[model samples]
Target: MARLVARRGRWFIILPPLLFLFVFFLIPFAFALKISFGEAALRIPPFTDLFGRGADGHLHWQASLANYRYLLTDDVYVVAVLYSLRTAFFATLMCLMVGYPMAYAMARATKSTQNILMMVIILPFWTSFLLRVYALESIIRDNGLLNAVLLQLGLIDHPLRMMHTTFAIYLGIVYSYLPFMVLPLYATLEKLDRTLLEAASDLGGRPWRAFFDVTLPLSMPGVIAGSMLVFIPAIGEYVIPALLGGPDNLMIGRVLWDEFFGNHDWPVASAVAIAFLVLLAGPIAIHQYYQVRQVEY
Candidate 1:
C-alpha cells in the first residue's frame, strides 16, 4: 500500500510537467519537422504545402531532395558550417581553460568563499546577454577603456582594433558561457574526494600523476557536460557574431537567418536548419551514448 501510494504521488508530480512539455515543446518540434519537409514558402497565401501546387505558380506540394543537395554541395554553406564548427570548438576550449581552474579553486574554498565565488560567477547572468555584449564592445572598441588605459599608461601610441573581429567574437562567447562550464565542473569537483589524492600520493604518485589518474578520470563526465553546454549554444548563436563578427566571419546561424529573413526563402532556410541538425546529430548521439555509459558504469 505504501509503495503504491509513493508511485501514485510520483506520477502526479511527473504528469503535469510531461503534459506541459508534450503540448508546448514536442508539438512545436513536430510541427517544425512537418513544415521543414514541405513547401513552406512565405507567399501571399502564407500557408504550408505538403504535396501539391496551389493557385500560386510555385511548387505547392512537391517533395524534393534539391534542398538537401544544395546544402551538401554549396560551397558557401560548407564554409559557413566549417566557420561555425571552428568557432564553437575554440570557444568551448577557451571556456574550459578559463572555467576549470576557477571551478577547482571554488570547489576547494570554504563554504562562505564558495558561496561568494558562485554568486560572482552567476551575477553576470542577471544582466541581459545583449547588454553584456554591448558593454564588451565599449571595452574592446577603439578609444575604449582598454585603449584609454593603455594610452594613459604609455603602452601604445594608438587605440587597438579589437571590436568587429574574430578576437571580439571569441572573447564574447567565452565570457558569456564561462559560468555554464564552471558551475557544472564545480559541482563535480565539490563531490570529489580529497583522500583519493592523498592515497595516490602515499602510493608514490606525483601531484600531476595523481591529478591525471584520479581527478581527471572522475571529472570526465563534468568536462563533457560543460563542453556540450558551451559548444551547442555557441554553434547556433546569431546575436554575438552579428554584433561582434566582421563581414568575412560567416557563421551558419547568420546564413540561416539571412535566408529566412533577408531573402524570404523559408524552404532553403528550413533545409539549412535541418542540415545543421544532421551534422550535429552524430556528435550529440555519441555524447548521449557516452553519458548513458557513464551512468551504467
Candidate 2:
C-alpha cells in the first residue's frame, strides 16, 4: 500500500510536464500532420478536411500526398533547408569557440569573481529578446554605432553597409545564443575535478597539454549540450534572418512563413514543418544516444 502511494506520488510530480507536452507539442504536431495531407482550399482555414461526409450522405475518408510531393519537387525548399542548416552549423561553431574560453576562465576564477561573471552571463535574460535583437540592429546598421565610431576615428571614409547582410545574421545569432553556450559549459567546467589537472601536471604534463588531454575531453558533454541549445533554435530562427539578413537569405523559417502567410498554402507549409521536424530528430536522437551512453559509463 505504501509503495503504491509512493509511486502515485511520483507520478503526480511527473504529470504536469507530461500534460503540458501533450497539449502544446504533441497535439500541435498531430494537427499539423493531419493538415499536411489535406488539400488546399479557397475557403476559410484553407485546407480540406482529411475525413468528411460526402454529398452521397456516406462517410468518406481521404488524404492527398501532393504537399509532400511538392516539397520534393521544389528547389526553393531544398535550398532554404540547406541554407538554414549551414547557417546554424557555423553559428553554433562560433559560439562554442568563443564560449569555451569564457567558460574555462569562469571556472578558474575565484569564487567571488565567479559570482560576478555568472551574473554578467545571465544579465541578458532580464531584457526582452525582441528588444535585444533591435539593439543589435542599431549597433550594426549603416550610420549606426559601429560605422559612426569608425568614421569619427577616421578608420573609414564611408558608413559600412552592415545591416541586411549575412554577416549581420551571424552576429545576431552569436550575440543572442552566446549565453546558452556559456551557461552549460560553465556548469560543467565548474563541477570539473581539479585533482585530475593537478595529477596531470605532477606527471610532467604542461598546462596546455593537460587541458587538451584532460579538461577538453571531460567538457565534451557540456560542449554537446551547448551546441544543441544554440543549433536547434538558430536553425528555425525567422526573426534574425528576416531583420538582419538580405532578401537572398531564404532560410527555412522564412520559407515556412512565406508559404503559410504570403502564399496562403497551409498544406505545403505543414509538410515543410513536418519534414524539418523529422530532419531535426536526427540530431536530437544522436544527442539522446550519447547522453544515455554517458550515464551508463
Q: Which structure among the candidates has the greatest TM-score? A: 2
Per-residue CA lDDT of model 1 for 77-115, tens digit only, reads 999999999999999999999999999899999999999
* Candidate 2 local lDDT, 1-297, one digit each (tens): 999999899978899999999999889999999999998899998999998999999999999898999999989999999999999999999999999999999999999999999999999967777889999999999979999999999999999898988889899999999999999999999999999999999999999999999999999889998999899899999999988899998899999999988999999999999999999998888778877897998
Least well predicted 10-residue stretch by lDDT in candidate 1? 39-48
| TM-score per candidate | 0.87, 0.93
Q: Candidate 2: where is the Cα deviation over 4 Å?
A: 2-13, 287-297
Global local distance difference test of model 1: 0.86
- Superposed on all Cα atoms, the candidates' RMSDs to the truth, in angstroms, are 3.5, 2.1
TM-score of 2: 0.93
Model 2: lDDT equals 0.93
lDDT of 1 at 35: 59
